[model samples]
Target: MKAAVAAILAGMVIAGGVSAQTAAPAVKEDFKPSSLNQPGQQFPQVNSQGYARFRIVAPDAQAVKVSLGLGGRGGTVLAKGADGIWTGTSEGPLDEGFHYYHLTVDGGTFNDPGTLNYFGSTRWESGIEIPANDAEFYALKSVPHGNVSQVLFPSPSTGAQRRAFVYTPPGYDAAAGTRYPVLYLQHGWGEDETAWSNQGHANLIMDNLIAAGKTRPFIIVMTYGMTNDARPGTLPNFDVKPFETVLVKELIPYIDGHFRTLSDRGHRAMAGLSMGGFETKAIAPKNLDTFAYIGLLSGGTFSLEDVNGTPGYKDKVKLTFVSFGSRELEGNRAGPPGQPRADPRVNAEALKGAGYNSAFYVSPNTGHEFLTWRRSLYQLAPLLFRD
Candidate 1:
């Protein structure tokens, strides 16, 4: 009887265990898609030498491709692995510069969920930092860095206070007795004062260039190019007149008053990109007494006739520099379509014909993008502040 009871007890324990297992919930069959893979998973890595290799796992995917741009060869790479991992090796050397790239999983734009962002450019999650060589335009170097200060001051033209960013050169206070020339830099469409220092890397570029003795030491004043009543990103309701008034009357006076500036056209200059380029042409010609040097990057609506028509065009301005990318026009081989294209060389010839001393530069293999502008700023900086 006791042996019979022991067997029954063991059987009961086994039955309870089975019941517990059966009562538990089943795992869900359908799972939501995730932007990133597991942490241990590896992706392509490239360096200044322009080499890249990516390890992607896409078990359920029939085909996977890696889209490359900027620092490396820009094309689609096919997946090669079988255990749900797609792998591809880039061909040839990549361009020695910062590039934006993403993954095309079955022709879908997917930013890598694992990597950190460079911010402002909003290109993608994953980015490869390319080291600058002698051949590169602006290489990173160890230099005494300057700080960028964003300040909001009263604007009498707009009636509402606006924003502007000031870039003081390294050792600004150390050179206490020294007053610096100021460059009033303006932003193009879809950008503000933040654009230059952010995507343009204006501060980093200036810091590196100044350290390398590539550019003259000066202060960069970046302000909102839009009018007071103007909506952000869209063109303002008023013409460029309000913008000009804001800069000349309110913005410049505020900056000059607050910061130690030379306060004359000889020690002051104006420059901008796209719409700002148009502003430079409009304001500098009329207020030649305010701005001596002018630099236009990527876009301008002025023709030789316009310059000739403007009052005091010849005697007012000292030097003019116009620049554009070789791949600026539509269907250009250097860049994608829909970029602004104005031939600086042609513009220079016209300006000379109009009795204005001008120089033009077209960077090879660049488009109407920040890459071109950054390089343009580096080149134009040295030419500034020179007697």
Candidate 2:
């Protein structure tokens, strides 16, 4: 159990933020407006090689910098041209998928006017998408889609009405008697409930997966993890008991009562990313009779000892899914002498060898970001609710 907790902490530190950019030998000239740009605006462009170019109209500002590329160098600094426009290209190509960034102009932070804003880093920041090779899996297609409806449920524990987004699969309303399994999904720290649908495209991923007949249709419930109270740098002191009560005690019952859900331990699962994963680790193992399947995406892993220590984990838990970005694993691969690293993959293998249904995944060429979590969900959805 200590090793699993250590691995979770290590993952939080090593894989929780922006990745360092790698330098490219040459820049390509085939830059195009990013798909995430404003309707008619053009400026934040991405090239075929994933290099991002920025053009900001901050004429009077002494300097402009973008908070998107190359760690240790602060960020990419933009140069002012005669037209009073600041322009610059990233030092190298960025990783594929969505990235949250803001402009630092004369020591003031702001969002770029050209691109659309996304809620991240606890605020609305400019977002850009570097096209991915496997992007088609989550792409918008002509296939039947699901509905992501906003639901306001009573939370007596929190003394307020909490908001959650529910994703009902295609034909959910049309099929009268067919009840679906439910997966309670969660987001990372410094993010809200919208991160899973807006930033991660979780609904689209499920839509595509179901359209392809790859996975069983299920309902997904996403709500705030009640983490906003934890201000910058005081996360370790944050308490989970309050949010746990809101989720396990209040929200789960509300969802079961309202939605046409298969309300049983075998049909219900819980998974989260980053700190949300930490919450799952803290909550699910203790409430073994509530959640049968568990997943941690770029979150943490379960050691054999951790599983053995729990009272009914081996008998009640159906699946233990753990995932990380390939780069996140690289960051946790080594530790100083006498301090052995707790490798999540090694822990997963130990669980499997001990006659447990454990699965481990790594997103290629990514870090602790939305793309990693997106791919993790893509891999995990098929393995859930197999009964």
Candidate 3:
């Protein structure tokens, strides 16, 4: 899946707020500092309508533009003000949830000095938050939170120790002899292990779900999807076996042995977004004994043909959760090039028709952004680790 995340993000970042912003009332004046902003900064703000206003202080710079405001024509261009600060509003309203962006100052790319940084496109990019109506699901609440710890495991395949974030649910320590199911989550292309917790809020989502009694308690393990082997736009020749070996051969055993997990086929699952989704689709069906549940978020679809071809998919697979933002499925364009163009909805329906536990979901009024994946995880978590 090397560069696959980059490809998906390239196409996704540009499709922002295209259909969302329409002929409407004036942009609301209720702009508040982005939730992702640094503690004391107030430059980048988001209004109730999801319109983002940016303020950059670059007294000596000739030009400044925000890479995340209204895609296509070089994002939103900022005008120099009398105060020597650059300011601009997004050309259109952006989708709700987190968006990765950067500032172009005097023809050079740099992170927005105001907002917090997130790893995307293989670099630290500025991030902004547009509050979602269902944000409470992933929001930090008064409930007990899960622990996200970094683990260094020996990976003989790569000849080095690999790092992964392990999310052990709250009360994990109390249940001394109780073993839990495991979900091996993968981050998209160009992104590493941090994407799930840092950007997607996987831990928070799980905490809220477990707290509310909406889903069964399960451990979530996140790691890099091994996408750096190839550069962006070179996904055509990407190989899944290398990453599959790392995940199945090394990560699974290590987790089962070290953590109190139900190390069985029925208790394990795999899921990802974009390139990570692609990885889940490739690895799960073939390794039925390893993963019983599969999910793809704005990733690719698994046709009935794919299910029939995989030897034990029907018997071992428990759920096939397919999801995308309503915008990504516009004109039935789900998967990118190098994969089949079958609409995920149609494929999902086909799976259900063929007696598979397939669930399809769409995030309304959004594109291929984090909002899409966040909702996907929320919808998927409840269906996983179920016997």
What value does the lDDT take at residue 11 in candidate 1?
Answer: 17
* Greater-lDDT candidate between 1 and 3: 3
For residues 48-127, could you state the per-residue lDDT of candidate 2 as single tens digits? 98888999997899999998757314678999999999999988778888888899999999999999998877899899
**TM-score for each model:** 0.67, 0.94, 0.94
lDDT (C-alpha, whole model) for all candidates: 0.63, 0.86, 0.84
**Looking at candidate 2, what is the lDDT of residue 141?**
94
What CA root-mean-square deviation does each model show from the true structure?
Answer: 20.4, 2.4, 2.3
TM-score of 1: 0.67
- Which candidate, 1 or 2, has the higher lDDT? 2
Model 1 C-alpha lDDT per residue in residues 1-387, reported as the tens digit of each score: 122112212211111000112232433323222112335534445433445556666788776665663222345576666577776655434443444456778767776543433332223235543333533444445779888998888987668988999999999978888889999998665356776876567888788878888788899999877732443323323377888888899888899888889898898999887556766766787888899898887645345766677677677767788876555532332211233334446768888777787877776555555666777788788888886
* Candidate 2 minimal-lDDT segment of 10 residues: 10-19
Put down candidate 3 lDDT per residue, 246-266, tens digits, no spaces: 999999999988999999989
**Sort by lDDT, best first: what order?**
2, 3, 1
Model 2 steric clash total: 0
